[model samples]
Target chain A: MSLSVAMPDRRVRATAAVVVAAVLVVLSVVFACAVGAVHIPPGDVIDGLLDRSDPVTRQIVWQIRFPRALVAALVGANLGIAGVLLQGITRNPLGDPHILGFSAGAGVAAVGLLRVAPEVPLALVPAAAFGGALASAALVYALAWRGGISPVRFALAGVAVAALFTALSTALIATSKLFTQAALAFLAGGLYQRGWEHVHQVWPYTLVGGLIALIVADSLNVLALGDDVARGLGMRVERTRALLAALAAVLTGAAVAVVGLVAFVGLVVPHIARLLVGSDQRVVLPLSALLGALLLVLSDSIARVVVAPGEIPVGIITAIVGAPVLLILIRTRT
Target chain B: MRSSARRTTAILGTAVAAFALLLTACGTDETAVPTATASAQGTATAAATQAAPVGVTVTDLMGRKVTVAKTPTKIVTTSPSALEMLYAAGGTAIARSSTAAAPGIDTSKMTDIGSAYQPNFEAILKLQPDLVVADASAQAPLAGQFEAQLKGVPVVFVGAVKYADVATSIRMLGLVTGTAEKAKTSADAIDATAKQVGDAVKGKTATKTLVVVAGRDGQLSAALNDSFIGDMVKIAGAQNIAAELKQSGQVPGYATISLETAFKDNPDVLLVIVPGNTPGPSISSIVARTFPNLNAVKNKRVHEISLDIFLQAPGPRAADGLKELTTFIQPDVKLGAAVVPGY
Candidate 1:
C-alpha cells in the first residue's frame, strides 16, 4: 500500500494515483455543490451548471458553490506543489509554506495593508503578500546560509522567522476589537462567502507559479541526488535551488493572500503523494497537486456542509485529516 | 484618526447615574428572566411563604436554577452590555467584563474582569460579587465550567440580541436587585424614543438596507433582523436585505455574504460599523474598488457609525442605535435632541 523508489511498477502506481485523485476531486466538487445552507440536489447542481436549473438555484450553484470549491482546489494545489518543491530542495520532510514563514509573512503584510491602506485595490493586496513572502524566504535563506543553506539550518531559521511574523500579525490584530470575525477567518483559514472575485484574484498567480514549477521540476530531481553528484552531472545546484524556492514562495503567497492561511496542505500532501508514487519530481509534483486538490476539496466540502450555513473553517477540517494522515505516514515511513 | 480616539474609546453613557435611580423603590425583586425562577427551580423552596424571602429564585436563559439574594448590592457582569444594564437599573457593578467596551463609564476605575469568552475567575472572585451576570447569547450554560469556583454566587444569563432584549434585561436585573422602578424608567425611555423614531419612519417607504459590522479591520458580517442590531434596523423602518440569508457560523444573527449577493440586492443604504471613534477603513472605498456596481456604494448611501452607539451600547442607549439607524435609513426624518442616552 506504500511506495518506495525500489518499487518496480512506479509509473503504473503514479498513473493510478493521479486517476484516483482526479476522480475524487470531481466527486468532491459535486458533493460540495449539493450541500450548503441552501440544499440543491447533486443532479440539479449539474443541471444548474448547464443553465437548465431555476434562477436562484442556478445563481447559488454557479456564483457561490462552484467558485468556492474551485478556489479551494486551486489554493490547495498551489500549496501542495509549493510543499513538494520545499521538501525536495530543503531535503526536509517538514518543509512547507506554514513552517517556512512564507504564509505568516504574507498574512501579516496583507492584513496590515488591509487595515492601514485599505484604499489599495483588493486585487493588488496579493502582490504585497508575494513581496512579503519573498522577503521572509530570502531572510530565512540568508540567515541559514553559512556558505550555502543546509536543510537543518533552513528549517530552524524558518521556524524562528515564522514565529516572529506570526507574533507581529497577532499583535496587529489585537489593536482593534473588531478583528474577531475577520481575524478568526484569517487565522483558521476559511472559504466563507468566498466567490468568483477571489478565484479571479488568485488564479493568475497559480497559473504563473504552476508554470514556473513545471519548468524547474526536473532540476528538483537532480538536486535530490546530492549537490556534488548533481554538479558532476552538470546541474547548477544553488541557482536551481534559489529558482525553486522563489516559485514555491510565489505559489503559496498567492493562495494565502486570497483564502487566508490554510494549514497542513503543504506539509502533509507531498508525503501522501510520495507514498502513492515514488519520489520522482515530475510524477511527485503533479501527483502532489492532484492529491492536494482532492484533500482540500473533500475537507472543504465537509467543512461547509456539516455545519451548512455556519461554516467551520476549512483549515480545521484539513488539519483534522492532515494530522492523522501525517502521523500514519511518520509511523509507517520508518 | 479622529481626536475622539484618544479620549478613551469606552463610551461613558454605560457608566451612567446609579445614585440617581437608586432611591426609587419599585419592589421588582422577583427574578431576572421569565419562567426561569419557577421552572428550573421547581422544588427549591417554592412552597415557602412569600413573606420577606431571603432569596429570589429564577431560571436563567440557559435553563439553570439561579437563586440570588433578595437585595444583591455587589454585582458583576461577564458581558459589557450587562454591566451597562446593571448601571441603568440603579445598581453598581463591582467588576466588569472588558475594558475595550466603554459604556459611558469611566472604566479606568472599575475592576476589570476578563472578557465574556475568557473571564478571569481570579479577578471576579477577588471582588467578591454577590450576583454575577453572563451573556445568554454567548456565555450560556457557563456555570458548569466554574461551578466549583463560583462558591454559591448566582450567575444569571440574559439575552441581549434585540432592542427589546435591552429593555427586558434591565427589567429582569432590576427585579433581581430591587430597582424595578428605575430599570422600568430607563428601559421605558429607550423604548419610547425608539417608538417615536419607529412612528416617524413607519409613514415612509422602507429602504432596503444592509447593516454591516466591519468593526474588525476590513471584515464584513451582515446583520440580520433577528440580530441585536437587526431588531433596531427593522424598528427604524429599514428592510434588512441580509436578514433573508441563512444563518452562518458567525454567532447568532450575523451571516457571511458574498460581494455578489450585495451586488444582486443593490441595497438602498449601507450602515457600517467601525471600531472606536478612530477613523476606519472606508467601506465605500472597499466596495467601490471591489464591488463598484453595488447601489449603496454607487449612490453614496453608506453611513459609518461608531461601535458604541450601536453594537456595544445595548441597555439604556438601545434607542441611540435606533435613532442612528432611522436617520441612516431616511435622512429627512428629523430627530429630537437629548433622547440619545449617551453622547
Candidate 2:
C-alpha cells in the first residue's frame, strides 16, 4: 500500500514561482514604503495608496514614499533582467551589468552632461545615461573580440573598462568644486530627496528596456547554450547574443541614469533565480525580476531603518549583503 | 565559433562608433577661445566701470602686490572667513566658494562655487573677478598656482590667527580695495562686539570649554592655545584642552587628537565645528552619546557651530561667533545690550 506523488507540470511550476515571487515583491514594496526618515505605518501606506487618507499623510505616503518604493522596485526589476541577459549572453556566472562597464559608462556621461549643461532639465539624464551605457558595452565587446567573443576576455575587458570610466568620473567630480558634494552623494547611490519627477523620468526607459528584454527572452535562452550548440539548434547565435547584450545595456543604462551606480542587484539576483529555477531563460528571467525587486526593497528598507533619521547609501547595504553571497558562490564553485 | 566571431566584430564596431560619437559631442562644447578673451575683457572693463579712480596697491600677507582700481567691481571670495572679513571691511563682493546651501550671506548677488575645498576653477575664471580674496593661512600654498593661471591678476591672501588679527586683515583688505575708513569702522565694531560678549561671560564661573573640529572618518582634532578659535575661547575665559599639542605642521590647521585623549580632557562645555551637516554620530553627537561621563553632555551644555564663523576666518565675524558662544555657555548673561550694530 504505497502513496504515489506526481511531479508538477512545467507551466504549473513556472506559474507557482511567478505567483510566489509577485507576493514577495508586493510585501517588499509595503515594507520599503513603511520605513524612512518619517515612518508611515503599514496601514497609513495602504490608506495613502487608496487615496483614503488626510492631505498631509496622503502627501507623505503617495507623493514621497510611494515614488521611491516604486522606483526601487522598477530599478530592481531592470537590474534583474539585465543581469540575466548579461549572464546568459556571456555564459559567466560572475557577469553583471555594472561589472561589464555599463553603469560606469552611464555615470561618466551623466556627470559630464550635468557639468557642461547644469541648467539642462533633469528629465534628460536617463537618455544621457542610456547613451553612455550603450557606448561602454560597445567598447567592452569590441576590446574582447579577437575574432570572436570569448567569455573570459569579455569579463576581463569589462572589469578594466569599468575601472577606467569610474576613475574618469571621479576625476571630473574632483576638479569641479561646484558639484563635488552633490556629485559625490549621487555617485555613491542613494534615494534621498527624490520624488515623483525622478520616477516619471526613469519609468519610460525601464518599461521599454524591460519590454525589449522580454522580446529577446527566446534568443537569450538559445544564446545561453554554447555558441556551437545554439547555432546547431538553428538560432542565429551571434545575432541573438548581440540583441540580448543590447537589451541588457539599455535596461542597465536606464536604471543607472535614474539612481547613480547601484551595485550587486544585477549580478546577484539572476544567479539566485538560476539556482532556484533551472537555467531555462523563461523561468530564470521572470523569477530574477521578482527576486531582484525583493532584494533591493529589503536593502532599501535596511538603509532607511539602520540609520533611522539619517539613511545610509542603498549601494552600501547591497554590497554588504551581496559581497558575502558572491564570495560563497565563488568559493563553492572553486 | 564563427557566429561568436561575427557577433564580437559587430559589437566592437558598434562600440568604436559610439566612442567616436561621445568624443564629438564633448568636443563641440569645448570652451571657445573668444569666450576666454571675453572673460579677460570683462575683468578689464570692470575696472573702468567704477565711479572713482580709487587706485590702491597693497602687499598681501603672502607678500604679493594686489592692485585694485576703485576697490573691486567684481570680487570673488573663497572661504567664509575671508568673505566675512571682506563684508566687515565694507566690500560688497560675491562669494564663489560656499559648501552650505544657506551661506548666511545676502544671496541676491553672491554666487556659490560649491565648496571651498573644491573651488571650481572654471567658474572662478567665468566670474571675471577683479580682486580674489582668501585666507593666507589656508589658501597661501595655492597662491602661486592661481597667480600663474590668472596671468598677473592679484589674489589677496589675508592671514588671521587670533581674533585681533581679524582687524589687521580687515584694515589690509580695506587699504587694497580702497575701503580703509570703512575697514576701520568694521574693525572697531568687531572689537566692541567682542568686548561686550567678553564682559557678559566674565566672572560667570568659567566652564572648561573644549573646542573640537571634526576630521574625515569621524576623527576629532582639539584646537590648541594660540590657534585662532582656541585663543578666542581663552579670551572668552574657557580652558584650552589641547594646549600641550603643537600646531599642525602639514596644514595651517589644528593638530589631530585621538578620541582617547579627547575623553581624558573631558571638557565641561563642548564646542564642535563639523565640515557640513550636524547629523547623528557626528563629532558633537558622538562625544555626547559615547561618553555619558562627560560634563557638557550631562549638563546639556554641548554646542555645535558653523565652521565658517569659528574655524575658517577669525576676522570681523569672530566676535559674532564668540557672542553666540557666550550665549551658549552662559544663557542667563545679558550680552544683547553690548551688541551695537556696525560696532
TM-score of chain A of 1: 0.91
DockQ of the candidate models in sequence: 0.03, 0.03
**Number of clashes recorded per candidate:** 17, 4
- Cα shift from native, residue A12, model 2 (Å): 3.6
lDDT of 1 by residue, A2-65 (tens): 5434344655665677667767877887888877655678899998766678645655676567
Which residue pairs come into collision in candidate 2? A142-B12, A148-B5, B96-B113, B189-B343
On residues B125-195, what C-alpha lDDT tens digit does candidate 1 reach at each position? Answer: 54677888877755543455444345446778775777877777777877788888888888788778878
TM-score of chain B of 2: 0.73
